[model samples]
Structures are given as C-alpha cells and as structure tokens.
Target: MVPTLNAIRHSRRHLARWMRPQRRPVAWTFRPARAWIRYQPLGCIGIIAPWNYPLYLALAPLVDALAAGNRALIKPSEYTPRLAELLARVIGRAFAAEEVAVVTGGPDVAAAFASLPFDHLLFTGSTAIGRRVMAAAAANLTPVTLELGGKSPVIVGPDYGVRSAARSIAFGKFFNAGQTCVAPDYVLAPTHMVRPLAVALLREAQRAYPTVADNPDYTAMITERHHARLVAAIEAARAAGAEVLAHEDAGAAGLRKIGPTIVLAPPAGSLLMQEEIFGPVLPILPYDTIEAAIATVNAGDRPLALYCLTHDAALREAVLARTLSGGVTLNGTLLHVTQDGLPFGGVGPSGIGAYHGRAGFERFSHARGIFQPGRFNGLELVRPPYGFVARRIARLLIGR
Candidate 1:
C-alpha cells in the first residue's frame, strides 16, 4: 500500500511532464483550417470527486483546470477522508493557496460548495448525486461537466478469446470490489458459453488475487451501510428466483468478505439487473444470439463504457455504430481511460461531458472567437447611406 501510494503521488505530479513541450500547449489541431487562437483563461472551478479512484479522478480534473490557467476548489468525497487529506496535502505542495484549494467535508459542505458561482463544475459520482449537483449549479446558471456511472455492459461473442476475455472482465468487474463507474456491470455471454465464461472468471479472479480473505489487493467496501446494501441487493435478487453461483475458496462467511458471486438468468427487472451492483457480484446473462445482446444494451441508457470481445472487424464496427456507449474496447476492458489522447467521459444518462487530453483543457476554458477584420473590406456595401446600389451588394454578402 505504501509503495502504491507513493507511486500514485509521483504520477500525479508527473502527469503534465510530457505536456510542456507540445507545439500547441493549450490547444490541439486536427485540421489545417484554423489560425492561432489566443489562450483564454477560466475563473475558479469547483470539482467534486467520488470515493472510488479518488486520487486519479480528483487529480485528472484538477490538472486540467490548472492547465487551462483556472483556479480550483476541490471537494474530495468524505468516504475516503484519509486519502482525501493526503491528496489535499500533495495539491497544497504543488500549488498556491489561491490557485488550488482542497476542502473536505460532508453533504452540507458539498451543498454550500456547489452553490458558489464557479466558472464551471466537474462532478464524478452516482447519478442521484449528479442530479443534485446539476440543480445546485443551475442556481447560478453555471455550466457543469458531470461524470456519472450506470450499468455498463460487456458482450462476449462466440469468436472471442474466452480465457482472455474472462480474465479482463473479472479484473474489471471485481476490481475495487466492482466499484468502478465504468466497470463491466454485467456480462452478456453467448448462451453456450455462459457457464464456461463464469467458470473462467472464477478461476481468474482467484488466480489474480489469491486468498480473497487476506488479499490486500482486494478493496473493502467504503462503509458498513454500503456493504449492507450490497448484501440486501444480493438477497433480494436471490428471493426473486435468480440463481446464485458460488466460487471456490472464496472466504469464510463472517469476514465481511462477500465472495465472488455470479447470478445466472436474472429477470430484467430483478434488483440485480435493475441497478448498478457495486460489489464483487457479477451477473451473467445468456443470449442466444449476439444481436439479442446488443438489443438489450441499446434499450437502456447509454453507458460510460462498453467492452466487446470479438475477432471480426466487420462485427466490431457494426457494434460500434449501432450502440451509443461513451467508449468501447475490443477484446479488452478499462484500457480506454489509460489513453491520454482519447477523450474520457460518458454519454446521455451515464454522463453529460468528456474531459481528457486536449478535451479536458478545452472543457475548463471558454473558446471566444477572435476575428481580426481587414482595414477596408466588404463592409462598405452596408454603409449608413443605404442606397439601392449599395443594398444590392449588401444582399449578396449577407444573403438578405
């Protein structure tokens, strides 16, 4: 934990090391039609980061706001106070008090903080909290970039590498106890491969982090309330006629260590399928055909990320065009966020805005157009004289 923590601290400071010498420091040009635009700065931005991935999520947006030359007031989630404090200290060391400030508090503090008329607000958390954040920001008519999470799905096609797919899915779904916003919420495996995928996931999870009981790699639920809620959700789904599949050598039942749980053939409205399961539970739904699985995801709100396992390029492109996820990965998971160039964000209910790479810097700053007009030009056609001859030329220019 100490070594990992130290490395995270090191990485946060070095995140912008490669960004200094770029040809365009604050802007990116993908086409050649643009002239140099002045670097516009933004005012203070308020960032509300979530408990999961507190360090990365908080620092990513903070770095973006700073890169755009904006001051920031970050409110780290109260659930992880120790981590929150550590980050606050690190940020203080890196920046001045006026440039960046970290505030740690509860719900009331969050409400008060959000009410400030910040230039913009960047929030990463649950959909329920996102609504309140949006509403509070609306009080001042402030723009916001929300990074909310929903039930992101993973589809396993028959042509996929099942062993590799299982390993990736298991690491993502159960990593941080399945608390990731973009985690593979549930897997849609081919009907014939459903059982095999589940078996593979169980084996891979055990192999990746041996001894789920004493495994330091495994993350504990943030709070007792959250843990209880997860357990209740599992029980409710079980009572609703859902089949729960157990994994071996999981752990003793009393260690507050909920083992790797798999639910097979869960009803669409079942609690397990309805909401985001932020636990070590993986719901495996079987589909007879790949088309049926795609339809299932398309019917729901667009997810933060989608993981598809297939070897066919045509099929991959078809899925990419048909589905509206924020991001997609072919035969892999959680690697999209690692790409510094690709924009990171969500779509629709999953989220409203994206921020990463140049996108992140742009999100924090306003783009004001600067049109330097020539000394004497086409404007003479619309002079105050307003003669018929001049009117004819004005109409040509203005499309009157």
Candidate 2:
C-alpha cells in the first residue's frame, strides 16, 4: 500500500512533463524540417492483477493507465474477493464506469476479461497464465505487458560476512512469509559459507518471528491449498535427504501457516529446487567459484530479480555482466522495485514488459512521430530526371 501511494504521488507530480511532446533532432539532409514525438493515450487498458499484494498490483498499473489519460477495466483475483469488492465500490464512486471500473469473479470472468478488445492489456501473474492472457489478446492484436514471476536468486560473495547477508536474506524471504514475487527463492553461497549462512538465516528467522502459529507479525499462506503445496515441497526435500531447519513444526493445517524453513542443498530435481517456492522456504546451495554460481543462475529461465551481496567492484561488475534478469538489487534485496525512476518487469519467460513511473506512462501511451518539411525543401534538387544539378547533389550527399 505504501508503494501504491508513492506511485500515485509520482504520477501526479510528473504526469504533465511526461505528456509533453519531445522534440527530436532533424538529420542534416532534412535541414529546416521539424520532428517530434507526440505522446498519446492508447485508449482503453485491461489489467488482470494477481492475488498476492492484490491492492498494490491491481492499482499500480491503473495509476499508469490513468496518468496516460486512458480509461481502464480491472479484473482482480477471486482469491481476494473482499478487497476486489472494496476496490470496485471505491473506484466506482470516484470515477464513472467508462473512466475506470473493477470486475470481480472466478476464472471464467477473468478469461472473458482478457478476451476483450482493449487497446492494450497488462496482466501480472504466473508465467503459465501470462501465456494464456497473451494468447487471448492475440485475437484482437492487442498489445500486452505481462509482469510474471520466476525463481529469483540471491548470490553472496566470498568476502561478504555470512551473518550480514543472512540478515537481509531472511528479511526478504520471511517478509509476508516469503510470498513476495521478488523474494529470494534460493541462495548460492561459497562452499565453506553454506553451513554458516544456513545457521545465520535460521537465527534471524527465529529472532524475527519467535512463534509462527499465532504470531500477529507472522503471515500465513493465502489459502489452504497454497499451504499444502509448500508443506509437500518441504517434505519431498526432506525425503530426498536434504538438511531441513525450521522455526517450528512444518506448518499448521488450521492456520494455513508454514514457519520460516530452510532446505540446505536439496537434490537438483526436487520440487523445492524446480518450482517457484512462493512461501517461507529458502534453499541454500554451495558454489566453489563465482563463475559456477553465475552459470547455475543462467541454467534456468531468466528470473524476475537477482541479488548480489558484494562490495568488491570487479566481482560486482562480473556478476552484473554475466547475468540476465528483470532487475537487480546489489548488496540488498527488494529495494529496486520501490524506486519510481526505474522500470520494473521481466525478460524472456519471467515477464514481457516493464511499468513504473515514466516507463509505465510510456508503456500505456503511444509515441507518434511527426515531421514537417521546410518551405525551401532541400530534397527538390534530387527528385528530377538525371540532370547535372541532381547528379551534383547526389554526389555531395552520398560521396562518390
């Protein structure tokens, strides 16, 4: 909610400047002509927000759409019905139906919403569902901006202190019970530091949330099914002989909660390693060399976010150069997305496009280039039949 409010303030502050036309330089051959890019709204926009961070994800993009001077229709996840209803009521009262509106329902309604012939569609969810939304929009040739999720990784440099890195990692992983899209999915630590890192992470988790079952500070899985899936993954890793550390028992069925848990060196094929563990489960893997650690990240689909904890300039440069992700937070985690100046989205499978501040405004608006020829018209000399003047001008421009 703070991020959403910040986005609103940012849009209000800079929208006028973003809407102004940008003057472009004219080429030497087109002297006295003028060129500029005019920013125009792309008519109606369709937004399909995910269940996690329902209010922020749903309204953040709407902030961009509105700032671009476009009407929008939002489809909030069914998992958050109450918030969806509240969004509908408040937005409906503030704006006319054609200006802005919210739609709430199950998968069918979502599907129908995606199929609408809006000028542009922006969907934030899993990669599998993003594909479906893109396909539905294909029928109308509607442009799409997909903010999807994948396994975001954290890398701890050899020189960085284990406890310091652990503190930040634990904060990112256990915040909202690790349900955040940009949370650290797993860690690649120096071989000798793996055990120490794991211990520190556990210590930090315990200090943060001493009790998980009834702790008001601790968050639960959004649904019972989500809770079950996380438990199954942890148990699968344990069955595969991975070392498991937990703040409490795996989880409580009634509470839909999973205590902060860490799996050390889970088998490569285990569910914990293969899927996006959108819960309080962090896996620590050992790497003898930083190059190998980087290769391991590149081995999978491009992730949405990457974190590198290193003060060394060369090591940080190497990691930055060799990796590809939607965004990177150096020596920290989850802070890159908070800045309104940066563009936030994925590349390859993780996501399609970016949106935030100026990027969001431009994504929802079209830049139409306009050019006006001068009254003298330099091109007139080169347009006639093969005459001496035309030949001379061509030689001067193109060079013999």
Candidate with the greatest lDDT versus the true structure: 2
Candidate 2, residues 137-188, lDDT tens digits: the string is 9999999999988999999999999889999999899999998989999999
CA displacement after TM-score superposition, residue 296 of candidate 2 (Å): 0.5
Q: Which residue ranges in model 2 land beyond 4 Å of their true spot?
A: 249-251, 384-386
Q: Give the Cα lDDT of each candidate.
A: 0.80, 0.93
What's the TM for model 1?
A: 0.89
Error of 1 at 297 (Å): 0.2
Runs in model 1 deviating more than 4 A are 1-36, 248-255, 398-400
Tell me which residue pairs clash in candidate 1: none
Model 1 per-residue lDDT tens digits across residues 22-42: 233222212222333454667
- Maximum-TM-score candidate: 2
What's model 1's overall lDDT?
A: 0.80
